[model samples]
Target: MAMTNRDRGGKALELLREGLSPYVERELRRFLGPNVEAEAARLIGEDRYNAGKQLSDLDVAALLKVMWESWNDVFRKTLGFAERSLVSELREWRNQWAHRLRCGQNLSLSDSDPQGLLVKPEVARRQREEEQQTVPAPTGVTSSAATGVTSYAGGESSSPTPAGAPSTTAAPLKRFHGSVALSPLRLGAEAGRIAEEVLAHLSSLPGAQVSVTLEIHVAVPDGVPDQVVRVVMENCRTLKFAVHSFERD
Candidate 1:
């Protein structure tokens, strides 16, 4: 006898889980390491969920939310192309399931093409290049003595001297400051993490002192707030440093 719709769906889900098993296992290993798999197997059980419970009316919305969050976490933590490829595949599967749920149809979790999920090394490299390009370069403090105008790279007015005053050579290029404002969602730990990452990038420049100040705003996650984040680096002899800041929402 042919299998019922529920039975077929259950089998499809089983196949889907089986197909995803290797990728999930790989991610778990990377996140928790090789020993973690043994612990996970022991704790979560080798079986996926009870077959009878798998076909019930699941909250697809909540499932999608959790899957997206998991994908982001994995993307942030995993470093190489292989790991990223696994994440992409998982995300695609999640999207397919979400579309099926939206159409008010049941989905069979069957395995699809795994290679299509893996990101090509060249593609990953280009993505990194694009990301690097998007970040604005740090603007250095340009003095009127150097450019004959009281304007910095960002077009902000620097300290102006008298029109007839004798201009001396730029004051030995002492330090550089890059100011930024944070969004409401970028408070506490998120702000701290960004500060640390920015500092790390700044510190890579030769003879640069990295110092960051957070400007708190009264407003939260709406329009741009009144506060600003000022990052100051002292004794920067070379002009190689880049400043990048982001507001999280």
Candidate 2:
């Protein structure tokens, strides 16, 4: 029998719940302390099908609001969850979302452009070359003995040759590759507004999933940060989008 849209959505929700169970359990345990097991059981006990149905268009908007509020509460009470290091990472994710919101951009994550992040090797090399050219070499001095030190030959003997100054060279600048992921939803059209809002919210976290098989790297200096990622994932999940798994390089 052909499955109804509700049925399909229900199945998907079931899969999501099952797949995220471990992670959810771990996070709940970390945040809820001793009550984590009981709390998680209760949260999961809620009907997946019913929950999926509740997310229908009419109620999604409201549900999203509630979810965001809940996330804020959890985030605040999570204690060490938003440490300085994590906060720093979240800032970068936030910037990515800000760019997508303010501008129009989509990052493609596929085999050819996984995570929509890539480093142009040539650009890095060129930058290294430019840095090397800018550093100046130390000047060297050579001392020669004065042929006529006696004062009789001239009014004043050549000033004593200054001791040869040691020469030094600047260290060569090393090349490091840096790349940024484009937003999955490109900027421009009004259709992207929701994504922009979601991105903005997630960018404040550490990481997120951009697709079913691809997780957005939110680590800083290398990928998106944890807090921002968490926010992004929460937003995606709230929107009923499938979150992808990410493989670190």
Candidate 3:
């Protein structure tokens, strides 16, 4: 008989635990100090600490979450945006396994492409370059400090300075704002595609300090199962969704 999705998921989970355990422990010890378990407990949980005082005792989500939480402090300088994206993708896959374990459903193999999800750093950088090349620059934008006017597409808006008044046309704004609102992502493929587009956009931005925030509002009817909620909320927490609550009349 062929292995069920649940069995495959279990095997994958086992591999992740065994493969990541020693590396996770070593990194934590190096940065977090000799009492790795004690420090990790503060983030993962006290119960987990008491269970075995090691990363191997925890699940894949816990291990990935630890790396995410410590990324800025330790891993940021060492790893780049591609690595960050991989960690985020791994967290999503781990949560998918969590859902499969509970519902025994067939996994969507298309959404979980190994080539895309496990993209090498050099390939990601090259893709970023290609995406940047394809993005069109803003056109017909011109600013004149002399007349205090900004022109776009042959249309001019004037901010005529009073006699002897100083011109501020060249001054940069205090903040720059840009946003893209995606359609409601229901399927794994939809979410993954949108995520890749957003990453490409971010890669094209000018600065390294660009802050990105993801807001997800899960809308489910009253009859939704506890397992579904558990899995959704687990991924939400993994991604650090700001507010989690039921909104209904």
Best by lDDT: 3
CA shift at 188, candidate 1, in angstroms?
Answer: 2.6
lDDT of each: 0.44, 0.39, 0.60
TM-score, cand. 1? 0.27
- lDDT tens readout by residue for model 1, 1-249: 666543454355555555655555566566666564344434333223321222122222222222233443443464554554444444445444423333555443223422222223343345445765887534564445665656555456645567999875544445666666665653533453444446545676889877765443344466443344332222221433454344565
Which runs in model 3 stand beyond 4 Å of their true positions? 45-52, 101-249
Clash pairs for candidate 1: 180-229
Ranking the candidates on lDDT from highest down gives 3, 1, 2
Clashes of 3: 0
TM-score on alpha carbons, each prediction: 0.27, 0.21, 0.39
Worst ten-residue run, lDDT, model 2? 54-63
Ten contiguous residues with the weakest lDDT in model 3 = 111-120
lDDT of 2 by residue, 1-249 (tens): 676433354344344444534443455456668864444334334433224332222122222222232343343355343342333333334333322222454432123311211122243244445765886432222234555232321243234345795554433323222233456443222222333344444444555434212335444457776887788778887877665443456
* Most accurate candidate by TM-score: 3
lDDT of 1 at 54: 26
lDDT of 3 by residue, 1-249 (tens): 677665576577678767987777777777878667776776565433234545666766678777766665556657787887888777766655543324555433333333312223344345445765887534446667787667655374556678889866644323334455566533333444445545544555676345666666565666668787798789878977787755454
